[model samples]
Target: MANATRSGNYPPLKNTEHDHAIGPLRTVELHPERRRNTRRFGICGRIAAYLMSIALAAALLPTPIGSETAHANGACRTDDHGIRLTADATGESPHFTSIQFLSASTGRAAGNGFMLGTSDAGCRWQPIYRGKLTFAQMDFVTNSLGYVLAGTSPEGPAMLLRTANGGSSYSPVPNGGNRFARIDFRTATEGFGFTFNDSGAHYTANGGAKWSKLPTPPNTRGLRFFTLEDGWAVTLAPGGYLVKRTTDGGRTWTTRLKASSAVGVGGAVYGAGGRDVWVLLYGGSGMSQTSYSLFHTKDGGASWKQVVSNATAGGGPAPGPAVKAGKLPGPAGRPADMATPDSRAAYLLAGSGAMDKLSLGRTMNGGKTWRNGAAAPGFEGKLTFPAAKSGWLAVTSLTSPAVYATRDGGATWSKTFAIPAD
Candidate 1:
């Protein structure tokens, strides 16, 4: 199962003017009574002391704060964002690690041993399933059909659950001895179950009732399919990474792109219909910062152009290309979560770590122009947008278990719902 508490660390900010790190400054005495020296001063000495006090007070003035959140009465408030979606729904609270929406009003949220369904844009959520199983992966081919991969541990014999009434209930599907680490559906009745590592895969044509062995390219990480016969995969090549395309349902493959910097596909491949597709590629190590590249293809991977690339260390493609010269936004730290609602619109939550403040980068013209804005504190984990202007963010902090929503393309957000108490 996915852990919602997983977060990236924010890098220390640089104060270019002072050539120092930006953080809490040394405490200064502003009140006259708090002064340590008790000796009375002469006329000239009093003037000097008064000037020094003025300088210190000027230094203590607060900087301009971001409009994303506010601090009042010793608490962070999001009142300016909007009204809450609804009061907290009562139920057994499960730590939600992932949330997906079919439309503005229909969706599902899942975590360890539980899943909840909302039909009215999170105004009300009903418990759909509860058990001693961790939902590792979830996919829905339609509003009334979906699947969840569950297992006792992160790795092992996973059980498949199928829901046909919009996640109102689920039933077990026979596994047929196929140990799958993940599953992706290209249609309601056709899908592929991928095993751990690039071992191979299992093919099912009748809604996962039975399966047969399917061959996979070496070092295959995962698969994204637009149809049963048209899909894409990224594999570990000898020198770097290789983007492969398959038109025969994984029966055959073709090399589409080769890169030494990109480690692999970063997140979900989004598209408008099946003609235009966009994917994010990222690489780098924990010890060093990494850059992400966004690629676009309007002819279904026939041709691709790198529209946006983040800057890396040493001015080289640390993982991707160097930042476009004044053409797009620069690095906002590693991409923690991203949502591409369509071919022309995308949102990226960029930050370094879980504790660091995250910035929201939005592009409405296919990465042509990006407006980077501030995100609310503790807004991390899975991010999704059912529409270009409607988005949801699940707060990963255990102490702040709430979900946020955006209606203005992530310019602002409001607390929409909260995980109920046990």
Candidate 2:
């Protein structure tokens, strides 16, 4: 590779500066399991749980599974089946980097120190793994099969871990120091790991027990493959970002999109498959915040459309990714975080979260349109939809780290359980 720049890989697309305007201060020490593998790029290391543990004495008990009891502060609602999410292994706060739902009733959250899994909605949760380091690019292909690219660096090759027991435990997949930015599986036995550094791209025909390199675009930064062969690549340009696609795995490439100034300033690329793809661009300057641009394609990369234009704030720009096209997020925030369950459904988070209320967005018809939606108590910090209208969402705030469920799409959310913090 010629001029490759190191970005991050471990599903590590959350806030780089967790120190800015963080929630109420309460410090806690990290458990011995919290591991720091040496940050590769500019990714901030999650040293310890940001805040001390809140008084979780009342929340540790098992509440009624389906009963919702409104509590004080209008913040802490305890229902039957309520469980708590913790911040990594620190057991301090429940702030998390990634949250994914394998099914409407099953999901997981990755915090600074730990990874927790739930099956009975949010009613209860079990610790899947309690170790050091962060887990990014988390993907659960089935009820029992899952993959996470683990590392300390935000922008570099990360070690890959595989689980055959429904995220109960994860063991490293030997790629020999190969830095994988992301992992995608089209089937149970077929997958691809987009890489950084000299490893290039790889293909695993037998689940990830072994990997083989594929011919990939040089200096590729981000990889989003809809299938084993069909995918999109986010690379670097002189001024902004570059987009590429491959129909035959990484064996070939084609230029499909380009932005001199934006798709978004800090925006990213997301895809549901060959026909549905999105590029979020940031058009803001360095000083103040600005609105973002969303360029989407429902026809592979053959053509692109601008569904969302930019919105500004206070003569500057909004501080985060807000959905200005509708009233879902109001004017407080934009769509900063995104998760696409399929080409028809995509979820967006309203704020740069720590531990508070955030709005949510959902589009049921590709990226052509969106609807104002919300979750109970708080918005989703991390989300996943294993099936249409069937998803598990985790709201990892400092106050109450919990998961919720949406059955008839994202219109209504019910509490599953709360994540336990230290």
Candidate 3:
């Protein structure tokens, strides 16, 4: 059933009518004339928002932002040392997809026309809220408190916003009709969210006001919780399904491991601390090729292993043919599908139709072996680092959508903005 939209919300036209029809609804109606020409370029837009806030003030100024003065307001790029900024929460252009940071100056960014903030990090990006939804996901545990998760429109009601001050202002965390796809918080009260159908899982210890539903195990699609007890949940059954665990926060949950019936776990599930976790499976279902696995566990969820396996496994990369030049393959064609770690080193973005690849794997000698770095440009959606050497790697371009950055971790990259081909 799980598919309603007559006011029950959950209708972003069934996921934006196949590829965001009409460019994210005309970029959310030209975002108030692009915020009145960025406040009439007041003081040169405040010196380009203070040189893009020196790349989130680089963990407290140790001297960064040098790579020919970092620049790319369209097709993103920033890595001469790394520091690229672009937030167009609806200013006619600059459509930041998803970004989150609790430090490095404080951060928050959502796309399609509203939800921006920057305590001095990205130089200056102001806008606290705007309705009509399109926020994909965001989570912060301190700095003030956070949560975003949006995609509403059966009429309304499918949000989850919350901010205790760090974001300036944000409220609305009722969500009884349940439609969240991803959300994870470890402190600031306690958190965990999931609902793609298989209908189960949702909890709040006070930060979200009130919520409770935990049980999830029936056809569970995907979920990853880092704290609030530990966290983990996966179920689809093709080979590996069901891996629930809760130290004690969720009250009770225990099932350790069960992933290896033969291999066929979908996609999306990430973690960094709380024992370092990661999951990305694809074999069929528009993911083309056939094989692409990367499962790792440090102990939190008891156990799990299968470091890395790529080549689409037999059902992942198939649409190849129109590469008159080179590089192009993301948008589910295969290659832009994993990002979920705050440290322990983790960053993988691959797409091959138009060519966009970047990988920087590190397990601190834990996940066994995974070492590869250098490659960027060709994104699918969602990849915000914030710190760990700088972040922001959004890319979804059929014609215009870009963002990139890497300090010295992924090697060398540049280009930091682009979303105007209209």
Candidate 4:
């Protein structure tokens, strides 16, 4: 038999079982025994044998089993059953980057290349969207109205896509905004958009139907808005990070607290409601061995106190291919997150060693006191606490990405859903 060598004439094929089987058949004409047999059979017989071999090889080619319906133009179309992925989805485990809960029983999730919706909290999920676009952030003003930031590839110019029927379908918002790294909507008509490395922001007063440029301070890392004119943001300062408040909207900012540290890199802000809020500071110089500080304020940034002085954040960014074979993948993009249920209760998840090696911390008395909560298994992705005692967590793994619920704060947890690749 002739040795088979792939050429550059066609797209590279994966080394799947079908490839191994079809490879030799395609190159059979080069074999010494087959060449002699072809000469003895004459041209007509040779043609007959060649036709049979072609039929045999065609039968071995794998057929796609995806449930996605085809459009008239041959593009895959999405339906109630989202785009189904093949067995080999990607090189690593599926990683869910963000989760948005509209109510106690309904929510949506965005991951590497897909989005999911759950009507029974995190107990069950339905694939709502799938494609090659990378989801950066998502915001839902109601059960049936939402927005998402996505781009064609990882190096993104994350534009806006609006959904009206609870993400069943989406359409691009005309001149809505572009390259917005994060978006927060305080009401159906009041929303804000911020960029990671720029000075100008965008705001909408009519539920994203139109957008207007809102000048902002440079180097803003995190933001949480309470109203169109009132909000809090974390900005890069000379020493470390500055927690600033903008009562006149983004036009002006007042430093509420200065988190000065030798290793302070950036920070994120989270709000419970009314006057309760938490600020998580990321402190580290490298991707490994991250350290964090948690601050709390009961009077809406009027006064701030450090509740947790120092805690170890195990990882920085998502690990590279050097990670051990079976180890869980790490979280990417945003490093830490906080869920505030009330004026005196909040749960914070931050990187422990890897980006998703998360540790849970709970504070029941606003920010006056905090305690460690039971850590759920797998890499923690996002947290949503609807009440002081009822909360849901999204956890990611290699084979199955799941959702876990906690009824008594974060003291205990139970698996609710293990999302299968569909």
Identify the candidate with maximal TM-score: 4
Write the residue-wise lDDT of candidate 3 on 240-270 in tens digits: 5555656665566676555443444445567
- Give the TM-score of each candidate: 0.66, 0.65, 0.30, 0.67
Ranking by lDDT: 1, 4, 2, 3
> Per-residue lDDT of 177-227 in model 4, one digit per residue for the tens?
456777777666677776664334688877567788765566777676666
True-structure RMSD for candidate 4? 20.6
* lDDT, candidates in the order shown: 0.58, 0.55, 0.50, 0.58
- Alpha-carbon shift of residue 256 in model 2 (angstroms): 2.2
lDDT of 4 at 42: 86
Model 4 — which ten-residue stretch has the worst lDDT? Answer: 17-26
Which candidate, 2 or 3, has the higher TM-score? 2
- lDDT preference between candidates 1 and 2, better one: 1
Write the number of the candidate with greater TM-score, choosing between 1 and 2: 1
Residue 384, model 3: Cα distance from true site in angstroms: 1.7
Error of 4 at 156 (Å): 3.3
The segments of candidate 1 whose C-alpha lies over 4 angstroms from its true place after superposition are 1-94, 141-144, 153-158, 165-169, 197-201, 212-215, 262-268, 272-275, 287-289, 311-316, 324-333, 350-359, 420-422
Error of 2 at 298 (Å): 2.2
Q: lDDT tens string, model 2, 1-422?
A: 01111111111111111110001212222243332321332233332211111112112222455432233353434332343333344344544667776555556766555666655454455566555657665787766667777654333346677765555345667664567766777677678776642225678887666787776676565566666677677666666656788998777888877655533234456866676787665555432323555566766656665444445552233222333333212212445467777776766665434324666656676544555545644433666777778776666565566567778777787775655545
lDDT of 1 by residue, 1-422 (tens): 00110111212322222121111223222234324332355565556655654443232222233422323453443321222222212332345567777776667666666566555555544555555555666787776677778754433467777765454345777667767767877688788776764346677888777787765577776456666666676677765566677778778998766555644433334555355666666665452344666666666555555555565562335333443333444335666667788877878776555344556777676654566677655434667798999988765543455667788898898775665433
> Where in model 4 is the C-alpha error above 4 Å?
1-93, 175-177, 197-200, 272-275, 285-287, 311-335, 352-357, 419-422
